[model samples]
Target: MSINPNQYKLSDRTARLTAQDLLPTTVSAGTETREFLQKVIDILLDYVKAVNDRNEKVLDFHHPEDMKRLLDLEVPDRGVTLQQLIEDCAVTLKYQVKTGHPHFFNQLSCGLDLISMAGEWLTATANTNMFTYEIAPVFILMENVVLTKMREIIGWNGGDSILAPGGSISNLYAFLAARHKMFPNFKEKGSSSLPSQLVMFTSDQSHYSVKSCASVCGLGTDNCVMVPSDDRGKMITKELERLIMERKKMGHIPFFVSATSGTTVLGAFDNLNEIADICQRHNCWMHVDAAWGGGLLLSRKYRYLRMAGVERADSVTWNPHKLMGALLQCSTIHFKEDGLLLSCNQMSAEYLFMTDKQYDIQYDTGDKVIQCGRHNDIFKLWLQWRSKGTEGFEQQQDRLMELAQYQVRRIKEQSDKFHLILEPECVNVSFWYIPKRLRGIPHDRQKEMELGKICPIIKGRMMQKGSLMVGYQPDDRRPNFFRSIISSAAVTEKDVDFMLDEIHRLGDDL
Candidate 1:
């Protein structure tokens, strides 16, 4: 029995079919698959609608049995109805706590950008890796384009860049790149070959990532000197220079300097121009961790001169997720030289993925990255940038700054009940809640120092109210301050106004 030529006989197509079968059998957008997907989507939409409708009652969705069962998965199991998945998710949503909702102020993270969220869905579905030009051709090129655009904005004369998993890793890469620039031999010979006294510097106001970088790079966390900052949280440029000189005089290698465009506690911007000059003089690598304030790059209203010296730096860490509102894990570690990253991270995966280099063995992105299979995080960022364009982003940036200023004003207007402290560097407002009951405890440090132990008291009340969320903590650099991060594009004047009212109202009866 011969099959007709057009009848599509099964020749040994088993290889292709077998490969397809090996992958998790996800439904494609075929007739049946599309219906299943639609069902899933519809179920999710309804579930979201339900939560939105009865938001305050969402605690019921927090059942952990569903979680316990999901964790119990051992062998392959048949797929359940989309309804079952939706129900399980709804259970999770009970504790989900809507970050996108206007009320979610508890985190530096905030509401979703709809377009970016949809882009993330597309990225997940595609799930391409970001190593080289072969399999991830589109994403790799987009990475180059987006990073180059940022470089031009950062005032670079054609810098090289790579996408890191997060701002933290981006900071780590900056440290490594600076180390590579200073001691290129260190990569090949390890830290043992370098001066034992190598040290780096950051501001008292900078992110903890700098300290983490020191520990990770074998410089010892104690080796990372925290320079003092001015009252406004800007780096004390004089102190910084003195610290560098001190380290150098001790026969220690001062190889890197990190300036913050936006600090964690107060959103402080270190004097980048001044710090850059110091780094230039000391022959140290200058890295700007603009993970928070880099979003200000989109704004003519705020990019300010803080970013002025970024391009002069050996590297930068910019996370679009923080202020630009892209999905999480969308950060870039860019270098002034083209091959520095690859030089720092290259290994011979030659046994698996490389060629003699006489011809383009294109499908490899493994060399320049620390990760072997980095998920495609570029699409969401690229998609958001595309949809918003530079202008759209600038508008968003300007508006957020303006709203922040507005929030500050409203908070200050209540000088009696709430004490708003600190000028914003990237839209974080710091304050303290002094209820009438606690006011007698004396606002003096002698009494406040003891009260610091009972911080859980008011935080618990705030949590129960659920009217809004704000962050709290105490640091030695500054007294106990509640940090209010304005990261959501959805935040309006009403939301901030309500937040102030809630803080005061909660404190009043407490």
Candidate 2:
């Protein structure tokens, strides 16, 4: 039976206290607050149970206006009662899509690790900034330990690293650090002080953040040279060398090369060894954006997917949130050289980074980062790592890869009804759902165009059904194809089959 929060009338708890009791004073409201908190805890528990329940709908669909009316989302001058607040919380959960659901393959990130969630709650309770050890002593150390572990996994013995807001910020940090490495004086004199046009290289299949970093860092987006990729989406080493030579001939300074361990749409890994060799030849700083594929490092069986020449990279961006299933916004950027982070982005403030603190000032990491006050993103990941030992994480990663292979096999069995984009290099399985009408048709441009048009239409129907969630995107000229990723260990072979069956049921008519 549903616990109707409204049934708990005001006379039940708050009425026991007077107006003076409600007001902030020396008196403690522990009893009332504890009762309210217990109710809130019940709501959270219910939400968690629903997320794990396969019988529950992935999302309760509603149009914008309807959702607004259903939620009764309105800000009031006066605070709401605890009962109304609980009711609102329940309503909010009713509409939210359960990304933790086994069948959810909508994005690169989805999973609810209970241990990590507990850490997240504790982190919220602590509510400390990660800037200085003076404030966030435990979290600061946790960040250092986590980052060092990541660097060691990348084969770096000692280096500088910082956790940023996201992978995009991490990439930007690499871009800025590379720029500073090339022209040390640019920090004080600005980009105009540079001798030549600054240029960076990344594969055309690389994340758009690389190009965005170029534009944000004052290097024109045009200067962000995109090297061609092979059919598998790995950067072509020969083409990269040619681009470097052409840029050098044109008097442009090639300062950075970003090698993606996992491309977005296809989950392709660039040739890191080759990319590193070219970077060395061109005297450019090498960065590996392993945001999506970095978790593979934990797996002994699949670590080779991202291991080759990773140590050669001057910097690497890793996000534990993606494949490792840490909470959101857990991204780290590492540098080969010590103190480069401080040299590149530090803005020392005496108020924060005081020199005469009794404790060791080396822990005052805020000065070395772009953001002054950072969130405590390390604890959840740290706690998760502690809960799931190194070997346990490796098993988790291996299991995910196995699940991906299982999905591929299942898709291949229904070959006439599906078109495999390519053999997946990682956990991402890309394919198009060929409807009955299009299955027997000749593979041609017209057929591709028809498939593309039907993808979104079918997607709309799927959304209405709310049984499962998956993402679709066009890879270059190819039509919009479904990209299913396996990130959560919670997803089983049964869920994979359910997703496939749901897609077929939704798209077969088209």
Candidate 3:
């Protein structure tokens, strides 16, 4: 009788769930359905129970074609049954599952915190918003609390914060807030009222997001002056000061200076103390893009002197998803000055949010943020924090740093194989696959440039094998180094070792 009678139906969920005419009017959760669900629960429970067991045959379930097929957006409704979906997940989607797999040294953030994943399931089911206190009181309060914790770590006393989608948007919020503090007239009349001569400075080694912000802010990408970097990719403070003085002498109003902490390619933290002094002297807004290093702010012993002068900056962007291993889309932009974000993106929504100014009108995030109907991304992170506690995240950070050190130590002890490109700064250890093709080369500029070409050849072989994955990028004129981000709490030394072995094996073939 249609497999089962009672099912998950639409009329219950207006916003997210709806009925489909092409398919069954309702999904079954009847007696048969209960039996099916019990079986499904048994399977999922087994998987979770076997989380630490990596030698299982379930790892080899999905072939290349099966994975390629799964990427397709649309297919016949009910074409993939719940049983089939479970089988595929247990088989086809093996490596992608973050079980701290020994060889899965691929992405920036890896490792499944049991708590984080559990929170994710709850959050997806709840599906709330962070726009107003009347709606999401708990999450809204948590956002403020978490942001305040970050601000306190940054040494700010009474600063404000707003959560954003990612690090890119977090940096954008900082820029917008700074712009509001500096040039409020632009909000009233747009870029026409502001000086096109307004310039910003970030290192040649800094993120592309800085230049992207320039593009979005109408300052033009050309205005994002790439200050020279040292061999280690940290921006030269003196050189930055020189550039600022030169820009000022040339009558360019230097508005912002973007200093990076644990940069993408090398995990290099710029001299924030020195940079902050320059920004303070020139009355320019300083923004520390600490998306990569912000997690370490929780690690008192190891946060380093990286963000020493952070409190002096006008704003800072710290993304928990990248470092804290909260789920994706958990980032925040904090400011020393209060209400700048509200003042920047605020619009008089007379038909909706505004008009009743007598009430607590400061009760909206849509105006302070670039997105309306922003997903309630806070709960996954807040619940994770609640479950794990701040101390757990701090220990996770310490463990990652320790893991990064282990990678460096293992690579450095070897003289001729993998080059420990830079010492483990934060959680990144960039290195290269020193293939036999470029081995024992003459110490000349020509050979140095030739070393740059070896990475892509080796990387191509790695991908073709379809076994392991680690991102590679050339940064600050260094020979292309494989950038290893130990952002995953699931990763261990064994994974790093396997990653190195894979790189070596692939490079030897090349």
TM-score of each: 0.86, 0.96, 0.85
Per-candidate clash tally: 4, 0, 3
Candidate 3 local lDDT, 1-510, one digit each (tens): 011112322232221322231123445524334444454455555555544444432133246786677544355655544544334434423444433444445566655566766777777767787776666767777777777777888888986888887888888888787787888898888878776488899999787888899999888898889999888879999998899888888888898899998788778888888898888899889999988888878887666655667667788888887888887767888899888887888775664466455546566666777776777777778778887787887788889889989988889876477666667577777876666776776545576566668778876665656555577776547666688777776667887787788778877755
Candidate 2 lDDT, 167-230, residue by residue in tens: 9999999999898888889999996798899899999999999999988878889999999998
Over 4 Å off in model 2, which ranges?
1-11, 15-26
Clash-forming residue pairs, model 1: 61-94, 105-469, 131-365, 132-365
Model 2 C-alpha RMSD vs. true structure (Å) is 2.1
For candidate 1, give the lDDT: 0.73
User: What is the alpha-carbon lDDT for the whole of candidate 2?
Assistant: 0.86
Ranking by lDDT: 2, 1, 3
- How many backbone collisions does model 1 have? 4
Residue-level lDDT tens digits of model 1 in 73-180: 333356543434434444444455666666566666676777788888888888777766667777877777888898878777776887888888889888887788
Give Cα-based local distance difference scores for all models: 0.73, 0.86, 0.72
Q: Sort every candidate by TM-score, greatest first.
A: 2, 1, 3
